[model samples]
Target chain A: MKLLEDRIRRDGRILGTEVLKVDSFLNHQIDPELMAAIGKEFARLFADKKIDKILTVESSGIAPAVFTGLSLHVPVVFARKNKSLTLPDDVWTADVYSFTKEITNHIMIDHRFLVAGESILLIDDFLANGQAIEGLLSITQQAEAEVVGVGIVIEKTFQKGRQLLDGLGVEVESLARITSFDEGKVSFLS
Target chain B: MKLLEDRIRRDGRILGTEVLKVDSFLNHQIDPELMAAIGKEFARLFADKKIDKILTVESSGIAPAVFTGLSLHVPVVFARKNKSLTLPDDVWTADVYSFTKEITNHIMIDHRFLVAGESILLIDDFLANGQAIEGLLSITQQAEAEVVGVGIVIEKTFQKGRQLLDGLGVEVESLARITSFDEGKVSFLS
Candidate 1:
């Protein structure tokens, strides 16, 4: 966790008073070694939970979720943002509203992949408004799967996402928690 | 390679005579243990190439590329399919036509991640028509980067992609090479 927090401090860029651009290392351009470490840390944190599978959204969440799947020896399922020709008809889906893109993406997972009564661990890159996580949770609930926990790479505590998850009573673990941004500097929650 | 081939044979679904659905392991729902092996295999294949970075497109490509980056100890940069508010205006952009989706996506790579004269190894989930690879190649060329080789998870020899890459005189290594699909059965190229 300290490793991630330190790297974030050194490489992370602040956009205005809200966005923390980690495309340099976390999302767009990835450092696999760092991702591997982050994966191991997530594995350590959720070692006690009964995680049958790990779920995440496509594009950004696949890297961290897959590495965590590697360490945990579980399968990682990424909810697709779009309905592709290859995708089948039977699927569990939910709509996610992205505040940044200002678009509502219909995210779905194949029903064959997620079974009822399976223990799911939701992993993601950032937890800001919590729309993505909420969508995944909705799908899991529809599938009758139990969401055991959530592992976030970076979380903005100032946002409403943290409170939303807290109200749901799910155990959320974020590697780096940002409390506020002061003068283009990140302030982590102590 | 045997492991991956075996996985495809076991879990891969043949849709009609052209499509091979590998969402069970390769793309949608990922098996990290297999992915780790895949990473090691790609590293072994490109060990001789001086790869300064691993480049691929976002979503599906991130999994294999990140794992490959881990094995090679290099940075992995995935071209974003869409431009977000966080992305800077300065970027190398290309238009990729997805035959499956019937859409032209404007993929971009931040100019800061890729450097001139750096050797890059292009990684992707599938090489059907080689449109994604060609797009990445164009971006790399625009950035003045050298593409040393390409690592593909699956290659359809029946498609024109192989011939295109061959004509370009670029070294390509595909983990599973499919010669044809006979009556819903996959035939691998030996």
Candidate 2:
């Protein structure tokens, strides 16, 4: 977590007050070494929960999900942003609003992947509005699966995401939690 | 490569001549151990080539790309499927037609991540019509970057993806090359 926070300070760009652009190393362009370390840290944090699967949304979440899955020796199921033809007829879906794109898209997971009674850990790159994680949670709930915990690489504490998850009574862990971005400088919630 | 071929034979479901769904381990629900093995295989196959970075598309490609990047000890830059607010103004974009979605989507890469004269190894989950790689090639070409080679997890040999890459004079190594999948029985090219 220290390493991740340090990396965020060094490379993360504060886009106004709401967004932290980690495109240099986190999401758009990935640092696999750092990612593996993050994964290890997540695994270390959630090692007690006994996770059967790591669930995430597509695109950005795949990197850390893969890494965490590697460390935990579990399978990672990423919910698709679009309903591709390859996806089977039976799927667990939830509507997720994209604040960036200013649209709502249905995130889906094949029903075969998320079976009943499986324990799932949700992972993602950034948790700001918490819509993405909420969507993932919807799918997990629909599958009649158990929600172990939520693992996040970077979290915006100023936003309602953590509060929202707290209301759901879900255990949440974020490697880097950003408290504020005042004057384009990132401040963390120590 | 042999291991991957064997995995496809064992777990892969043939939907038709074109679609081989390995979502159980490859794409949707990822087996990190198997993916790490794949990453090792790709590293072994492209050991001779000096690759500075591994480039891939988001969603499915991120898992193997991250694994491959870890094994190779390099950065993995994935092209964004949608234009996100986090990405900067300057970007290299390309239009790619998805046979599954039956629509064309623009994939973009942050210009800063890719520099001129950097040798990149393109990695992907599947090589079907080769449009994804072609779109990546366009981005690489625009950046003035040199593509060392292409590493594909599964290549549909019946399709023109390999031939297209061959025509481009690019070295391509497919872990599993499917010659035919007629009647749902996969036949691989030796």
Candidate 3:
């Protein structure tokens, strides 16, 4: 976690007040070494949990999810952003509103992949408004699967995402939590 | 390569005459152990090339790209399907037509991540009509980066993807090459 926080502090860019761009090593461009370390941390945190599968959304979440899946020695199921022709007939879907894109899109996972009573861990790159996490949780519920926990690489703590998840009583672990970004200077929480 | 070919023969699904779905292990749900093996295989194939980065499209390609990047100890840069606020101002973009989706969409990569003259290895989950690979190649060319080679997990030999790449003189290595899939029986070309 210290390594992730340090990397964020060094490479993360503060765009205005509400946005943090980590394209250099987190999202768009991935540092596989750092990602492996982060994956190890998540695996260490949830080592005791019975995680049958790792779930995440498309694009950004795929990197960390793959690493976490590797560490946990489980299969990673990524929800596709759009319904492709190749998708199976039976699927569990939820509408997620993207604050960054300002559009509502459906994320889906084939029902055949997630079984009933399976334990799943959700992973993602960023948690801002918690909409994406909420959608993933909805899909898990639909499948009758148990969400063991949520692992996030970077979290915007100043936002209500953590509060929302806390209200739901879900255990959330974040590598780096942003406390504030005032005048382009970033601060960490705790 | 035998391991991958066996996986495709065992788990891959043939949908009509056009689509071959490997959702069980390749795309929607990923087997990390198999992916690690694939990463090792890719490393073996491209051992001679000095690859500075691994480039691929988002979603499915991220998993294998992550593993490949881990083996090579390099960064993995994934081109995002949609333009988000987090994306940098300057970008190298390309239009990719999805054979399955029946629509053309643009993929973008941040200009800062790809440096000119850097050797990159393009990796993907599938190579159908070669449109996605062509799009990735276009983005790399726009950034003035040298594409050392292209690696695909599964290649449909019946399609024109390989021919297109062969025309370009790009060294392509597919773990499993599909010769045909008729009456639910899949045949491998290599």
* Best candidate (score: lDDT): 1
TM-score of 1: 0.96
* DockQ for all models: 0.91, 0.88, 0.85
Tell me candidate 2's TM-score on chain B: 0.94
Which is better, 1 or 2, measured by TM-score? 1
Stretches > 4 Å off in candidate 3? A83-89, B83-89
Interface root-mean-square deviation, each candidate: 0.6, 0.7, 0.8
DockQ head-to-head 2 vs 3, winner: 2
Q: Lowest summed-lDDT stretch of 10 residues in model 3 chain B?
A: B80-89
What is the TM-score of each predicted model, taking all chains together? 0.96, 0.95, 0.95
List the lowest-lDDT window of 10 residues for candidate 1 chain B: B80-89
In candidate 2, what are the lDDT values of residues B19-75, reduced to their tens digit? 888999988899999889989999999999999999999878999999999999999
TM-score of chain A of each: 0.96, 0.95, 0.95
Sort the predicted structures by DockQ, highest score first.
1, 2, 3
- Model 3, residue B69: distance off in Å is 0.7
TM-score of 2: 0.95
Q: Residue B117 of candidate 2: its Cα lDDT?
A: 97
lDDT of 1 by residue, A1-190 (tens): 7898899889999888898999999888999999999999999999999999999999899999999999999999999996343445799988899998788888999999999999999999999999999999999999999999999999999899999899987789999999988988778887
Best by DockQ: 1
Fnat of each prediction? 1.00, 0.98, 0.92
Please write out the lDDT profile of model 3 over residues A1-190, one tens digit for every residue: 7888888889989888899999999889999899888889999998888899999998888888888888999999999886343444688988888888778878899999988999989999998999999999999999999998999999999887888788876678898898888888778888
Model 2 agreement with the true structure over A1-190: per-residue lDDT tens digits: 8898899899998776687889888888999999999999999999899899999988889888888999999999998886433545699998899887688878899889999999989999988899999898888888999998999999998788888888877689999989998988888888
